[model samples]
Target: MKPAKNSPRARIVRYTVFGAISLAVAVITAFGYLRYEQRVDAMHPALTGIALQMRHDPAAWTRQERDASEMLRDIREEKVAAIGVSRDAILVSTQTGAKYFVTDHNGAFSNALLLGEMKAGADAPYQLVWLPDANLQTGMARWAAAFDKIRDLITLLMPLMLIGGLFWFMRREMTGGAQLLEESPTLRFEDVIGAGEAKAALADVQSYLTDPARFTDMGVRAPCGILMTGGPGVGKTRLAQALAGECGASFISITGSYFSAKYYGVGIQKVKHLFELARKNSPTVIFIDEADGLGKRTDTGGGPAEAESNRIVNQLLAEMDGFASNQGVIVVAATNHPENLDEALRRPGRFDRTVQVRLPDLEDRAEILRFYAAKLTSKADDIDFGQLARLTTGLSPATLAMIVNQAGLVARKAGASTITAAHFIEAIKIARIGDVSGAERALSEEERTRIAVHEAGHGLVAALLGTGVLEEITILPRGGALGVALVTKAQDKHLYRETEMRNEIQVLLGGRNAELLVFSEASSGAAQDLQEASRIGLDMVSKFGFNVDGNLFSLAALPAQYAGLQLKNAIEHANVLLRELDDACQALLRANEPVLRAIAERLLESETVSGETVEQLIREHAAASSPSMHLAQEPAAA
Candidate 1:
């Protein structure tokens, strides 16, 4: 029995055989034509020499030249047997078995002499005849003849070429289904450090891919797509890889940007082909990174690029919903910009499952740190992973890995065998403030003193106010700032209390206050501090409902044109609020002036101070203010 012509296997076999045959024919035809053309070209110079010789001295010519001249003089008058044609000459053989060369160029005589010696090795004598342009016209006509033959060959194969291309494209589109199917996963779900919830969600997906029958029995359809959303470096793409790895399915990874084109239909064709491949390879995981670029909302005002994007998006939607049964082709797409993706793409049928791959929290960061730390070898001591995690409160898993890798490099550069607490600390500072060591920002004694005073004020106020934990204070210049008071929350907080927010405002003003107290004026160094304070203050009044009225409204939701009025009102309210806070801040600073001066002195001496040292100093000052007293025994003696 013969197989059906339209069957997939039959198509593959037919096209494979057809392509092989077509390739062989093309090679043969091209080879024959090229050989003929080469032979014609090769004989032109020899023929030109012989033709010139015949023209200059017909009496000196051999029997071949005399006979050839008659034939060559009027090439169309009689049928002259010729080997080939040239642009301006022809090579012909006489009835007497002699060879003759002909040309119209006057310089052919000199060239003919050279060709005679070169071709003399063949032991064939030839004559040169210089014919007029009129006689040479017939020789030039052979180029058109050659072109005609080439055109005919091309005409013969053009249809076949087109058919072959269509067949190859379709085959690729069909077989593209599962470019790879892994019997086992190279990366398991456990390998991904964070995204526990996302990992759990994908576990069910793996079950569907591995055993769809179990779900099918329950009348549940497998989700066609899972959209992983998060900020950049949040491990969204890595989770996609882990999903494929866990499921042991074929992985076809492509970027969303791959399906965008300047030309129309190209992108749509690509999208169709991709889905066709996935359908053929039923148990396949298609991972698209940066999917927002491929599936952006269509533009109402259409252009070529816009039209192409819409076509691709439409094709993607069709493909996702095309299969009647759960084909086990789970598309895992990752995009940092979920809001930019088309609404249809995020709807029920397409990317039905959305997993938020957020920044790793404290516990997640600790585990992630340990995972990366284990990859390092020269560790003299066990790192305080808890302390490292606390320092990097909002850092991504990727950033944590970087810190660990950078710490190893730092330790190696210092000729240390193991990564120590100090190495990690330096790495954190480097990650936060950048490498100031390379900048060579040497400050004068007076300038260093002012920077010390400014940073000391920030650290002292933050410690006193209990707004945040003062990590470190440095007078060294880093990241365009003359100094920095590194303060961080002990843990990540999604919501800030009113007192905490107020204290933050005070802390921001500390640097400016310190400068005012010491120099009786402030410098441009407080620009960032003032800007941050203003933003927090304004947000308190406008967005957070921290004003007198205690009302919350979404200022961000307002139109841009109307925002100016709302923003002005917010700024007015904030100013009134800050005025009141300013008095409290001034009074607090005045009472803690001694502590501020003490911290500043220490900073000037050491150029840096730890958080614990600042806390200890504040505690000592507090204790001294209410010194312990002993009973007066003198009264009893009297």
Candidate 2:
């Protein structure tokens, strides 16, 4: 059997062919250059000193008669073929096809005559009148010119040849590199954790891939393309592979970036080849990951880049439309940004169905956690999936997996036999904020006191206002924060009430308010707290339309003519609302100053305080202060 195009043997053969061609070109170029050099040397023979003296000063030859005899002897020894003299010139010819000429003045050659000036009976300038082989010299000069031209031509073509070869190799790879899985993916529907709705949406696709003839008989067309849209790591690609595995069809996966190349038309070729391969396999599933890389093309009348993009997109559309619905070739593509794709690709008869793989919900998160936890050699029964799911609200499936894996790693690092709740908790902290245990900075007593107070203030206020369940509050530094107070809700919330938003803003301001009340001034640590509080206040006023005036006009809906004035009003209203909230927050903290101080002192002692401990502290302080006065309870479900 022929070797695969990308196999080592094939690669070696391909490279060898290219290498041989390059070597041959190099050899020819070198040979031509050497030959040209030889001809050049032959064309210009070296002259002797006497020959040079005769040419420059012929009269010196007559003054030095002995020197003339020596010149004759030297000429005879040097194989000078002939010598000619005229009234104003003398010429010497050599047997090896070289000729030298000298001008003679003062009638230096009275008896001698030039070849052109010689009569039939005139005495000859020399004993012998020989002609150099003009034909041989002319031929050799022509040959040298030819060799020089050949060398220059080869030198010029070398780079072009190499570039052309490279383009060919790249084009071949780009168009043919996408390999179908030697064996179909084994990831079935059961293998995918979340994305129930997405799976349900793809049920028909699964059925058709299993039995295309069943649909064909009923004259029903199977979905030719599926576009899975979701945030990254939401299991879209896995779901696609599952669809293929469910039917045991061939799976071919290629990223959208695979089609992009610097060479013109290479992308188009890749697109065509990809679809063609899928069709040939019949009952094949083509999964293109990160399809947004080949997204909507913008026409700025730009040059080749824009044109190439347009062509690639156009080719993709054509391929999708060109295939028949019953061809049993389904093209599944996943993209984080589905809106960026070309409209043509999303139209009917192409990627007609767009499946949204949303983030896993509470129940789904619980299921996913159980699925991953079951695979680990841990106390899976002891692990509370519900609590873990609640703690990981809004996290993707990938992050959930990472948390479980990290938990196992944490357990292993502790030299524990099985994972435990405490290990998982530590893992959660590491995953959420990052492992900053080693990053803790040495703080002075005063700064440590301030950090403890700041974090304690946040926890106390959150508990007092029932914003959320305080998970943990710590004076220990993590990430960029000198202190952190983590609060989690009882469950995920999709909507919020005006009072709840105000309560959240208060919780954000709690730290800063505590610093101000305790130290008579706030520190720079409140910068993030102030920014977050300001953002919530502004959103409430401008976006949520939660102003006191009861106006429902959103900032985004404001008329352009009134936008500036309305926005100014919104900012003023936000500022007024924040001041009011700040005053209320400070008052609450002042009344419960004992409780804040107690929490801060506990944090200073242990560097960390659990939510239950803070709540106990609050209850103790409230009861000690006044038996009749009740502390705020957790807010009721909306």
Candidate 3:
């Protein structure tokens, strides 16, 4: 039996690529020609400048005398064929095989070595012919006579030549030219992770695409469209393409941006062209990435430009709702902001199936990290995949991939065969923020002591709390801070209890508390730390109503009731909130000082402490006379 045949859309893509390549080659050739012409023009100026200088010279003869002399010279005629100019300022007639040079007396000199000589014409001898006073004037006159014809020839041919090449390139670009069907793309189902719930939701879509006849038999219309909505970077585009590839359907991918045109009818024309192309290639999936850009909601009061956008969108709606859409054509569109899309486009018959792509859960995150990790060099075999995944609490798959690549580079540089767990830990930190460009600083002995003590206070408290809240405390600078203590939970949770919120506030204030005890005044280095801690602590007391004092009652209700009103209220609330935040923040840092002081005194003696060291100290210290592992993640500004 023969193998399955190749798909049509694949053929279109292959041809399109070929056309683009041909166009690229033609453009390169044109550029080369232009450059050559420029160089020739650059050199022409020297000869032209010389001629201009000669014509404008004070010693030049009158026009009538020059013209009469030039006519007389021409009327004298050659022996047979016209003589051409040659090197040594001589003229050679090929027919007569004779050479003549212009003598000082304005007469032809035969066999005159002193004057100049030209060999019988074997080359373009006209190039070197000299011009006497009369000949020079006549030679310059010929240029004006010939300019019209030469320029017309160039003008007529150049654009036609360009168009011909562009047409040929487009033709080639739209053809397949024997593209292998097997290599269309695999898009294995598993490459898509975390959206398993989404995948599960969309399972029926495959049945609809593959067996539309089943619905036809039941006298029902199949879904001709599916919408994938998700946050940015959640792989909505990837899912659509993968599905098309997996189903072996013809995939014609174009951006929604491509459909929005400034010209009145152009957008509608493109839409018509796209759907026509889709209909011609049945079982085709038109994947428009970010379709909201094209099919935005129609506002009656919108301007002319928005009207143009709406027109294209209406055309798209017609194509989808019309009989053509149900005839083996499926349109899959992805957008982060689905709410912004025009309602007509996403109506029941149009974008009938909505698939929501979301961030992968923890297990999914682990799988994604593991897949990327496999490509990295000698990553430790038992490097705690679960633990690493847990540490990357809110990280996305894309971010995870970047982390693995960065750590692999670090491993490569260290001459280490395997990427150690430590390497990934560092990569995670680097990825979370940016590079630790200012990590190493010339710290005074006093500054180091203060920093060591401050960080220790945060690390010690979390260690003591056993909240799984503080993950790691590294003295190494990362991000804007010179040092940091990161907190994460093993499992991802959307909601935080009041206690969890307070614990976070405590961690933020830990450094400030330690600072006040170590130095008489709190360092401004804890500015961000204080700000963050104060806001949360204040919000808890005032807004969230989670505090003991009824000072929280002084706060107003939440803002976002009406659209414009919300923004105005939010601004006003921000001012009052700032004051509450400042008071609560100061009070928290001040109240926590006694406990923080003891922790800092211990940390001041210690140079660097990891999670392990913090835990050890937590075990060793018991409240006032007790040891604490809690440290504020606040590091000195880099």
Candidate 4:
């Protein structure tokens, strides 16, 4: 509804316009007063002497003296033209022939009470003239110039068209429509390939938003907060933004990190103010990115920072748990480290529903790559997802996009008209390690052979393992690595089997073993591989109960109570497992020693291989049961 015409806000717009006009008139009038009174030229005795003499002998005065009086009168009118009525001042006539009432007046400038009293008792014995409503005439003439200027300005502004737009804009802001959220593109369900459970959860929420009344009588309470928790680049933010678009609610986004301030309570105050603003416009969704900043655990013995942050979290908790349901106010917070959030804040009253956003599956990756490549030119008919997906194993959606963009850049730089499979292939190789252009790290020939063979060994092992896990092998170093071998899960299966975990560890070790056998020593190049493999093995023993040596029959995921705890527990767990972890890694390596050596031998031939190569190897030596199968089948062929 349009705002009522008499409302304070509407009046404010009108008053503001009037006040501005009043100020302008006051300035012009002051200028006129200064011009008339400040100069003191008209008030000079020499200038007035002609008028004094003319008054002494009314009929005997010369034409020059009369002209002087006329000039003085004209000057007085000019001074009055500039004077605003707000301040007290004297008034006079412009010409001798016209009466004071017939004289010109300034427009709209208020006439003053003191003006008449001063003119009536002027003490001019010789010229006894009492003017009627002369003050009103003077004010009208003085302010007329101001009105004329405003009218001219209004005419000029009409052409600019900003007046109407600004009026509507201010009215819209005053009324509440300006606070309405704008439309954003919502991703189709097809865009999100993994997290079926999370999708179902989101779907339910969508349904709730569509028909809140339907759930109202069902005794269901809308979730106050939907906590999207996952590793980085897993698309938590994209999904929430999609939800915002889907619901058509006001979307206000702020990062927890942006709340920092020198004052202890300033962040808390800002948080309250923001929430209040959001609530004032109900049916709003506030998305806080990286909420760990405000939600970090408070029990840690940090300084005053923890105490202040706790206050901020406390305010947020209150806001979430307030009387309003999700129908009125909904909050979606995304954080990579959900484990770092405070415990109290994660309870049901706060973030009632926690959605786990896991990595995308192969199909999802293919879709994501296709989505990103939509704008790029196809390099050749060889640009196949079958090969691309296999090559880009374990890459996040974001990483996949970067690879595609970089591939396009490579195609452009090479002066290729169309992006081809070779560009994608090169992009994948580069993504695995990173670009090594000019001043790129120069490895020794021996180191290069070792890295290439190590990656090849891993690829071969993954492909030869019963189900064939190896996706690709690259000598390109990416993300703090010399080279990497990628292994993909057959499907994006969340739960891992002991055998799969064991195979993954073995695959991780394949590179180190390949380097050791080929180069006779492992360099820091194996640092990342060893770190990953060790962590997996350690988790198997500590949390997953895969090791059977310690805490069997236990699910290692965070307990409901301790879900959003801090990093301290994770660190302590790593430390405790440290005492018993080394032996497990050593045992797994020892059992796979022969197999690793055999795989390394095969890798030494090619230095790198693809899933297709591994498949071909197994197909060529079908009778062979592992790398041993190749050897056993090999003797028959020989």
Candidate 5:
């Protein structure tokens, strides 16, 4: 029976036959061309100068005949049989049918003349002709024939090989291109840290996946899809996996870029295949990480890439919305840039719910640190999770985990049996800034002194103003900075008062002010300090309504239509506030020159001074300067 044309078996048979025919035709044509070349070469030998030389002068003919006779003597004892010189050429033929032709320059001999000469060669008007050995000539001809056959065979097989390779690759892509993870996730909520609210939000989806029949009977459909939006390393993907684990469902994971293919329609096919897999494995969580790869579509026409992206997104939407039954399949997608996702994918019925996974806060960071620390062989009491959490404000859970692991590494490198607080501190420094220990040894004495002065100035001003708890002051270069003054709040503060903002600006400018007071001129080392101080000043004027003019209205809060003159006034006011703050910082540095000098001197000796030591220096200076004044007790570690 004849098979259908589009069937896989039929297609394979057709391709095989076509490839075989093409290969056969190629071999035949190549062999025929080679044979024709060989025949042409035999008819007209490449070397023709010997015949021309013989015909050029009759006086030299006897000498040439003697030379040709000697040449024949070297060829395995083959004798000179005959010489046939035509009008245009002289021909020498070997017994093995190899012919050599040499041209005659003069018109002294014709073909008929040569034939007559050959017939009368035994007695009249004959010349000696060189003939090659029959055995050697036969062996060379056989090698040439073998080489030609090999070349023809390669030419024959090339097309077939290419076709077969293409067929195999296409079949593989059709059958197993889209990877699906059939195993259920092993990551439970207990295994995950941070994203507490996101976990709470996904609890409903977990319930639905766990018991789809209960929801189906009550006419309440499970959420078709969940979209997770967050910054990178905030645990959106972890949350999705945890949801899968919570319900003991099969997990199929793929990135948004998985639907992208070089060929058209392939992405759409992948989307269809992905959905089919999810359906086959009911109670499955299909996690698509980096969903922004689908891209936001436009109404205006674009290139082929844009069109393909649109088609894939459309197919995904269709699959999500066209499911015949709930089937306990939940489509979960995570994107760092949710705004870059297609609007169609974010529609109500399609995504059904959106969860935001934000950076871990202080308590959450502490929790994450504790979780990772428990996995390490460490002195548990030596590691201060609260202080580490306070220092790592705005850090993600991933970063917190890294801090723990890096601490373990640092401890091991130092030949310590267990991790310690000092190791965690070093790890935090590495994570926050980078390894600065090597860079510290490279600094010259002058640069070290300058850096020490700059960092001491920052630490002193922050402590004096009570802006926050002074953590550490170091002249060790970190990242782009030549020095650093680490500060942390006793607790996370979501709102700041105007005085607190101003005090923060003053601390930022203290480094530059200290430079001016000590060196009689400020260096360019305070460029970052100045920039940060300016930003805070501008925010106070335009955003926070803390302008010196007491204008309750925020310039940034105004619409663009009304911001022409108001924007300029806000900027002018910000500059005035910066000048005022700068003067205050200079005066403060001048007044506390003795304490600043003490801190900078200590730093120059140690390269790094603890915040408590800096605070102690300030307290001692205050007490000595004013005997009757009362000093506040030292603040506890954050």
Candidate 6:
């Protein structure tokens, strides 16, 4: 396995290697200069005398020298002492007084010593030596001469080294576009929390992958692609990983959005490259998270981004159903919006199977809670899984895991050794709504009482209507709401009848209804309630056609020409229906005024009340009105 270059250990090693190279280069260069200086010092005396003459008269040295520059170039690398002009011939001498002829003297003498001149200078030598300035012939100049060959060697090697390095980098990038995780995936199906149907479907796929020969013998080809559709935080990506792990295959994961680009053909090239990587690593799982982005419906309208997206989609389709079959490669894609995906990508030869990873139900929630809680070192048995499951009705498996983590944090904050039920309750509240204890304390007593009355109203109405199981009623300010009555459905409901819809609207307006019944006026606390109630009313009339006397006209499908008028008439009819529901809510609250009063009183005393306490109060109120109910029942029997 290659260590990431950005990892601390890798970075430290890289820096150490670079430093060592630099230090070695510096040492070698220093040693070369020192050796050159030692050689120059051996000819110091002769060089000193020549330098004095050159400084006094430079004209005599270079004036008769027609090839002075060439002579300097040729001798810079050589150790020479002096040079002189003897009539038309130039003479050179080393430090030992040995003479050498320079220039063309009688046709055949260049840097050649003259034996007769040595004897002539033995008695009384009369020689005028011409020399250049010592400034141009020592220290740096000497070192340059000593290291000239080494410098040439380095210069010659540099281009070859650069070319080799470039080739290696390009090769690494081209072949390593996606990491080939040689190790089998560690995630297993048991590691996943919910989505039982998705898990079962993926288990079958894993069987096909793990036993390819068995499938082939049965004349069955494995599905080329699988598309997991779900909302965010529903573990679509995790399911894909679990599939790979179950089959013990190499998992190459990438995001679909990564293939999109502003350039024309870059998207297409990247898509092809990704598939090629998968093929190279056979029996690979190519998991694309957020696949809808790359495989979106390709429309006829043209733009740079749209055209690029279309090209990426086309490339992906071709790779899935191309000429060669990808027998060993399985493409698993995840998307939150499967409806936005291209139809061609979902065809039989491509992603034939679409699995829905829906939100966890009560039992799933409890299982998810236990799964996460068991991973901790704290005491998990003290926490009631049944209550938690009922409380967290609509939470996804991801959110449930977070709740368990937050529970641990709460316990640690209070210096507890084990997470208890109180910690879980507090964590659940904090997860659903923000921690608002400080904000609650900021409110005056009058404001607190008003919030208590508001939340109590919602709780009473919800209990009366049997809309859902009431979890908790609290006066604490949370997430910009003055108060909240948390209700979770007893079970998941796919469709709603007209009675349930109307009851839900009534419960929403109950807070305002309570304020009017008790204080003879409503407060700004009911603003959110009114907004929610209005949205439901609009949806009921426009989207579902619950109003308009069973005409069954879908407002969403209305013609543009008459849409405005139709919508106005529908809303007007819905408003009349809302007025009737509001009256019904107020009448119901009045008939059960004693129940509402008792719950509001208990809330004001405690600032919060449990669901069980509310239920007990409702039973007591019903018992107190039994006589009137018996009298009404007698009239019905007669």
Q: Which candidate's TM-score is highest?
A: 5
By summed lDDT, the worst window of 10 consecutive residues in model 1 runs over 59-68
**Each prediction's number of clashing residue pairs:** 15, 1, 28, 20, 2, 0
lDDT of 2 by residue, 1-638 (tens): 99998999999999999999999999999999999989966863544454444444444323212223433554647566555454443455555645554434433542443333558787633333222221211224457668999999999999999999998898786775898999988898888877889999999999998887888899987788899998888998899889988999999988888888878887888988887788888789999999988967777858888888999898888788775633888989999888888888888889979999999888888999888888888887788888888788888999989999999999999999998877877787887876765445667889999988999899999999998878889987776778889888778788999899989988999998898878989899989888988889988988898887786778878688878777788888899999999999999999999999989989989999999998898888867867443333323322
Off by over 4 Å in 4: 1-180, 183-195, 217-219, 296-307, 324-327, 379-381, 437-463, 466-489, 505-638
lDDT of 5 by residue, 1-638 (tens): 99998999999999999999999999999999999999967864543444333334322332222223333442334432335454333445434433443444342433333434234335522243322211121224457668998999999999999999988866554333655565778899988876788988998899998987787799887789999998888998888888988899988888888888877787787877777877777878888899898887776668888888888788888888875554778989999888888888898988989998888888888888988899999888877899989999878888888989999999999999998899998999999987775676787898888888888889999999988889999888878777889998877777999899999999999998898899888888888888998888888988887978787787666688887667787778889998999899899988889999999999988878999998888878877877434333223322
Q: Scored by CA lDDT, what does every candidate get?
A: 0.75, 0.80, 0.63, 0.62, 0.78, 0.77
Instruction: Give per-model TM-scores.
Output: 0.72, 0.71, 0.67, 0.57, 0.74, 0.72
Question: How much does candidate 3 score in TM-score?
Answer: 0.67
Off by over 4 Å in 6: 1-176, 213-221, 261-264, 295-305, 543-545, 557-565, 625-638
Residue-level lDDT of model 6, residues 1-638, one tens digit each, is 88997999999999999999999999999999999988866644353465445445544443233343444443454445656543334545445544444344332332343222455437312333433222222224447666997899989999999999978865544333567667877888888877889998787688878988887889777788898998888898888888888888889987777776544676676777777877877788988898877657457756777777776787778888853458789989999887778888888889969899999878888888888888876667677888888878778888888999999999899999888888888888888886765687788987887888788899999988999998889887777777889987877778999899999999999999998998889999898888889889888887887875775777789688878878777778778778989999999999988888888888888878988899999898889799888998998899
After aligning candidate 6 to the native by TM-score, how far in Å is the CA of 307 from where it should be? 3.7
Comparison by lDDT, 1 against 6, better one: 6
Q: Where does model 2 exceed 4 Å of error? A: 1-168, 174-176, 217-219, 323-326, 437-439, 558-566, 628-638
| Candidate 2 Cα deviation (angstroms), residue 291 | 1.2
Which is better, 2 or 5, measured by lDDT? 2
After superposing candidate 3 on the true structure, give the runs of residues whose Cα lies further than 4 Å from its correct spot.
1-98, 101-152, 159-184, 295-304, 442-446, 530-608, 623-638
Ranking the candidates on lDDT from highest down gives 2, 5, 6, 1, 3, 4
Model 5 stretches astray by more than 4 angstroms: 1-153, 167-176, 437-444, 554-566, 628-638
Scored by Cα lDDT, where does model 1 land?
0.75
How far off is residue 6 in model 3, in Å?
A: 67
Task: State the lDDT of candidate 3 residue by residue for 1-638, as single tens digits.
Answer: 53335677767777899999999999999999999989966754434322343333412322222222332254245332222222222232223333232222233342343224446764432222233333432343457447877999989999999999977754443331212223334674577877886777666666666777787899877777888887777777677767766667667777778776545676777777777776776667778888777757556847888788777777888888876345878888988888878877777878887888777778988888888888766545867778788878777777888888998887887788888888887788788755676545766767766776678666655555555756656555566776676766868887878777766666666676666655766777788876776566556655665655434443446454544344443334444544453455456545555544444555445433456655554544434332223333234332
Displacement of residue 141 (Cα, Å) in model 4 is: 41
